[model samples]
Target: RTVTSKMDLLAFHTNTPNESLISSENGVDLSLGSQPLENTKVHFEEKQFVCSECGKGFTHKSALLTHKRIHTGEKPFACADCGKCFTQKSKASVLKHERIHTGEKPFVCLECGKRFTQKSSLHKHERVHTGEKPFACSDCGKCFTKKAYLVVHERIHRGEKPFECFECGKYFTTKSYLLTHERIHRGERPFTCSECGRCFTEKSSLLTHEHCGSAIGCRSCTTGILTLLESCAKDMRPIGFSLSHITYCC
Candidate 1:
C-alpha cells in the first residue's frame, strides 16, 4: 500500500502489522517495526562555515577560522630565530624557516652527496647530475634546468630589459648585469689581479689581463692595437701593419 505521510505510515503499520507500506513520493519500503525510510537516505556533510571575505566554504568551523587569517593578514606563527611571521596553514613552513638560522641542510643528493636546505633545491641540483632540462622556452625551444632561467631566456626573444641602472639610466635583461654596470659609475673595481695588483670591474677583464702577462705593460694598449688591426682588416684598408713586425713596447 502507498504511504503519503509519516503519521499515515504509522497508522497503516498499526492496522496491518505484517504488511509493508511503500512511500508514495520516493517508493521506499516502510515495514512495520522497521526504521524510517527517510533516515536511510545517503547523508553528506554540508560546508556550513564560510569565509566572509573570500566566500570559501569549509566543513569545519576551525578550518574556516584558520583560512580567515589569510584575508585578515594575521600571522600567528612567528620564527624564534629571525622573528619572521607565517600563516597557520602548516607548521612545516616554520620548521623550514628555522633551518636558515640553524644552517641545517636536511635534503641531500645521492649522486654528489651535496646537501641543500630545501627539497626543491635538492631536486634542482639533482637535475645537474641527470642532465635534465625540464623547463623549455616556447619561442626558441631552448630548454633550461630551472624555470627562472627559462623566464630570463624568453626575455631575450622579446627584447625585454626590466632591470635598470639608476646612475647611467641604462637597462639590462638581468639585475646582475645592472649591478655590474653600476660598478663603473661607482669606480668599484672589485676583481683584482694578484700578479700585477691591477683591478677590474669585471672578472672577465681581470682574466684577460692575467692572460696578457705583466711583460706586455698595459694589456688595454695591446688589445686596442689588435682591435684596430682587426677593424682595418675587416674594412680592407691596407695600413701595411703586421703583428710579427711590431715591437713589444707598451
Candidate 2:
C-alpha cells in the first residue's frame, strides 16, 4: 500500500525491449521478479520529446504537448455544468470535477460506508480505517496518511517555502497559506455574514461573529475575544454579575 516515488515510476519503464516488467491491478503487483535497472543512461537519451519550459523529456510528442499546458497555465477542458476548467483532458477528471456541482459520490468505502467523488480519495480514506501510513518523511520518522501531506511536512525540514507572496516578501510552505496571505494584501474579504453586512478574511471569523452577534445583536464586535466577552456577559448577567465588574476582569 506504499505510495510510488518518481524514481519508482521512471524505473518501471525501460528502454530495453521485453524487460519482464511487473504489472499491477488495483495497486497490487502480480509479479515481483527480475528487478529493473536503475539510473540507466537509456532513460535520458531515449526520451525524444522534451519540454522547452521545464526540460522534462517525454516518450511521445503528444505527451510533451499535453505537458506544455502546465507551464502555459492553459485549461482547455471546460466543464459545461459549472464552467470550471481543467488542464488534464481525461474523462476521469471531468467526471470527478462535475461531482462537485452534481453532489455525486460514485466511490464508496465498504469499511465505514463513507463516499467520495473520486477513486483516489476513497483509496486515501480507506487508509484511515486500516491505520496505514504509507508516506513517511525522510528527514524525520513522521508518517502521513497521504503522499501530499508527507511532501508538505518535508518542506519544514528542508526549509523550503515554495509558495511566495508576490504582493509582499513573505513566503509560505503551502499554497493555501500564501493564498490566505494574499487576501490580506489585496484587502479581499470573501467571507461575509448574511445576518450583518460585515466581511472577514476567513470563514471561521464570520461563523464566530454570527454565533455571538445572533445573541448580543452586536455585529460591531468583530473580534473573537470581544464576542467571547459579550457572550459571557449575557450569561453572567442572569447570575447577579455587573457589566462594570465583568469589564474590569476582562
Candidate 3:
C-alpha cells in the first residue's frame, strides 16, 4: 500500500520495519528516509483576499478592506477639535494631534525627565542620551540621530531644495527657512527686543540688534536704517544717532 497523506505515512512508518518509504501527495513524490518528519516544510497559509487597486494580497478580508483605504483616500478617524482626518492604520495620529490641544505629554524619558506628546518623539529624544545614530547617509557616511536629519543631509548631496516660497518664488533647502522667508511677505515681526520693543522678522536680526545696540554695525540692519533715514529726511524730521540709545533715531 502507498502512503498518500502525512498521517498515513506516520502510521505506516510506525507499523512497518522498512528503513525508507515512498509517498505521493498532490502530484508530488516524497522520499521519507531516516530524516525526521519535523524537518519537512509542508504548512502554508495562502493569501486569498487580494486588493484590486494595488494588487496586494492579504490573509484576511478585514486586512484587505483596511488596506483598500490607502488607494481610496478614506480617513474614517477624525479629530473633534481640528476636524483633521487620519487613516485607520494611523489611529495614533489622531491621539497625538488631540494632545496638542490638551497639552498632554504622557511619554517621559527616565534619564532626563523630558516629556513628549508621542512615544516616537520620546524614542527619538532618548537617542540623544544613548548616542546611537542608526540613520547614515549613503554618500558621505555621516550618521544622524534621526531619520529626518539623515534625509535632509542626503538632500544636500542631491542639491534638492524641495521647500519653496510662493510669494517670492524662492526655493529653500529646509521648511524652517521657507517659513522664515514667508514671514517677510506677511510683514510678521515675531522676535521683539526687550529693551526698545522693536520687532524683527528673523531671530538672528534680533540677536544682532541686541548685541550691537545700533544698526550701524550689521549690514542688513544698516540697510534698513538707511531706508528709514531716507524716509525721515523726506519728512523733514531731525534724527539723532547714538550707540546706547538707538531707538531714539527711529
Candidate 4:
C-alpha cells in the first residue's frame, strides 16, 4: 500500500493502533503521517540538515546538532581528576584518560605479568613474548609487533624525517630523538649517574658508566679502565674485553 498523497497518509495513520500526534516545542503539531503537514509544511530533504561552517549535512536533526559542535570547538566532556577537556563525550575516553591520574592498569599479561591501562596496549606487549609481528612494511620484509612501530620504520625507507631540530636544522626519525637532541643545544644533561654523580645527555651513557663503576670499584678507576680499553681497542681493533678484562686489570 503506497501512500501517494496526504489523504492516504492520514488514512494509514488513523488505521494504526496506539499512535498519536506529537507537538514540537514551537507548537507545531507533527502528525504520524508520511506526507508534509498542511500548517507546519515540515519536509525532510535528502541530507537536509546542513552545517553552516563546513557545509556538511546529516539526515537526522540530532546528528547535525552534534556535528555542529566540531565547528564550535565545544568539548562538554571533562575529566574529574585533572579537569582536562576532551572533544568526545564518550565515557570510555574519559575513563581511559582518568587512568593516567589513577595509575590503574586492569589489563595484565599472563606471560610476564606486565600490566597496561588499555587492553590494546597489553595485547601489543604480549606480542613481545609470542614473537608475533603482525604489522609488515611494504617497502621491506621487516615486520613489527605494533602498527606505530611499522609506520616509524617505513619512514626510514622513505627517508622522511618529519621531526627537525630548530637550532641545528638537523632531522630525526622520532620525536623523542629530536627532543633529546634539543637537550644537547640547551646543555641539558638529564640522566645522572647515582654512583659518581656525573650527568649525561642520554640514559645509555649513564648506564654504561654505572656498569664500568660497578666493575672497577670507583669513578677514577672506571675512567682509567675506559681509557686503557679505548687505547688497546684503538683504530677499529677487535678486542674480546669481557669480565676477564676486569679481573686481569684488578
Candidate 2 structure lDDT: 0.69
Q: Candidate 3 residues 1-250, lDDT tens each?
A: 5556567666776777464555453433334554455443352235779999878998789989888988999988777788787767465666688899999999999999999999999999999999999999989899999998988889899999999898889998899989999999999999999977989888988777777564433222433444433334333422343233333232
Worst lDDT run of 10 residues, candidate 3, spans 241-250
Clashes of each: 0, 0, 0, 0
Q: List candidate 3 stretches off by more than 4 Å.
A: 1-43, 89-94, 204-250
Q: Model 1 clash pairs?
A: none
What are the TM-scores, per candidate, against the unseen true structure? 0.56, 0.51, 0.63, 0.63
Model 4: how far residue 222 lies from native, Å: 14
Ranking by TM-score: 4, 3, 1, 2
lDDT of 1 by residue, 156-216 (tens): 9999999988877889999988889999999999998897687889997776666655334
| TM-score (C-alpha) between model 3 and the true structure | 0.63
lDDT for 15 in candidate 2 is 40
Error of 3 at 188 (Å): 1.5
- Native-vs-model 4 lDDT? 0.70
Candidate that scores best on lDDT: 1
Candidate 4 stretches greater than 4 Å from native: 1-74, 212-226, 229-250
Q: How many residue pairs in model 1 have overlapping backbones? A: 0
The CA-based lDDT of model 3 is what?
0.72
Show where candidate 1 strays beyond 4 Å.
1-80, 83-89, 203-250
